[model samples]
Target: MTLIYAMPGNELFAELLMQHTGYGRAGLSVHSFPDGETRVTVDTPLKGEQAVLVCSLDRPDPKLWPLAVAASTLRELGARRVILVAAYLAYMRQDARFHPGEAISAKLLGEWLDNHFDALVTVDPHLHRYHSLNQIYSRDARLVHAAGALAAWIASHVERPLLVGPDDESRQWVEAIANLLCAPSVIARKERHGDREVTIHLPELGRWLDHTPVLLDDIIASGQTMLQTLRSVCAYTTPKPVCAAVHGVFAEGALDALRGEGVGDIATTNSIATETAHIDISMQVAEALTAVCNIITERRWG
Candidate 1:
């Protein structure tokens, strides 16, 4: 039997997984001390069952220790195996040291996960520098693309959407979503000066002026890239632009900031929980988990 256990913030997502997988309910208790230390307790017997641990590593600092302890505790409690299903994998942005004495966080965190969990399953991770998760994670690390879920949401709502990509890096998935929706797409040029400072050079959108402009990016952390792109597109089209992203890590007041700049609609996958997270990626993740479970059952760990 597969049993699903959720870390503190991941309970709702785990419940969805349980519904799809028809997996039995299991629990994990988290207690934080006055000294900023964490205590993790597995609440049920996990002997000989595939223990699926749900912990979306968004704000990962506070949750890391609990996750580590929980995984270890599950193993100690006689779980046959431990699999991590993170809706959003964190610490993937920094793959190298750009300056002196900078830590390669992606590499380090990947190694840490390998040491703690037997397998990993997560939605789209930032892979600009690294080609694949295999480059970093040696275990059964799987990628569940959020494009299908994003496309599904778009198809249901907007009748006409001119898909807009923030950069060349976003081309692959944005194009996939566009194809699924059978919509015309364009790529914008982005020049990033700093974290919040970005300029987007949009192509002449006069031809597609009638269609609703949908700006799609893998992440919208600061929301600056989409903000600039929306403003540029607004110059040509009268229709209010729609912002679509996989992970809505709206840093600070990025959501309100985007709304302030006249974004008509904002939709993001539930990779990171937000009021803007209207698009649900749990079905996609559940499907991926079924495949992962099959592999684990077959003892395929490469």
Candidate 2:
């Protein structure tokens, strides 16, 4: 098996995966023409061997065409199997149409990926209504959680940490981390008026006043929820709360806004490459890939 990274500036993750899988690394070179056309080249031999493409779909729009071309090109080059390790799978929130004539983007993207790759693996995708990836994808799709990694990081870093969920949607993640650390947890009631405006009602935590509040969520897209929760919590507490997420999809000025709101610290897993990516979830992803590889090997031999 060989691993090929789709984009540049991802050598660190590729190196970690190489160490985990004991697989040789392949290169993919991309160039853009004056007419805004992209040309992708496979720089290594992959004939008759399994090839895995490591690409995180954070800012996925620009990378989609190149990725599609690369995947198809690999097959044309005689690669036996192609697997996609998308650390942060995008377009997962639009599982259903909110209005008439609206396209189900999640299902559409899944169909596109299914036609390209033999198998897929991702970490903590933004699944709202869809129960499983199999519901949307036809191929072998695996979802890996980064809760254990995030929980361990919280256990070592924060003192007297009180796990907090910005809204009911975040209860599962907050509770899981709280259980791992044997700490108290709280959930805030959220009412969204718009994309940028949200009202958060934090529960009374006078009993756990001594504990430092750490707001936990799966994904932070606009930072509105975190900001509102921070303001609500700080109104009664003196200690500035820490904000943590599994996927930090911090939009423009989102992180800065959080810091401006008196958030003590910010951290997230390396699912999406960002400056606040302090926790490494590569081991967890590599373990999932190892399981997939084992299953493939078994089927081939059995």
**Best-fitting candidate, scored by lDDT:** 1
Write the residue-wise lDDT of candidate 2 on 1-302 in tens digits.
65556565556777787788787888888899999999999865556777788888887899889889988988898887788889899999888998899999999999999899988989988788998898888888778888888888888889999988999989889988888889999999999998899999988989888788999999899999999999888877777799999999998989999999888889999888899999998888888887776677677779
Q: Give the TM-scores of the predictions, in the order they appear.
A: 0.96, 0.96
TM-score of 2: 0.96
* TM-score of candidate 1 on Cα atoms, chains taken together: 0.96
- In the range 1-302, model 1's lDDT, one tens digit per residue, is 78899998788889989999898888789988999878788865557888999989887888888899988888888888889999898889889998899999999998998898888889999898999998889898889998888998888888699999988888987899999889999999889899889888888888897999999999888788888888888889988889999998888888898999888899999878789899888888888888888888887445
Q: How big is the positional error of residue 136 in model 2, measured in Å on the Cα after superposition?
A: 1.3
Alpha carbon lDDT of each predicted model: 0.88, 0.86
Highest TM-score, which number? 2
In model 2, where is the ten-residue run with the lowest total lDDT?
1-10
- Which residue runs does candidate 1 get wrong by more than 4 Å? 300-302
User: Lowest-scoring 10 consecutive residues by lDDT in candidate 1?
Assistant: 38-47
Report how far residue 119 has shifted in candidate 1, in Å.
1.0
**Cα-based RMSD of candidate 2:** 1.3
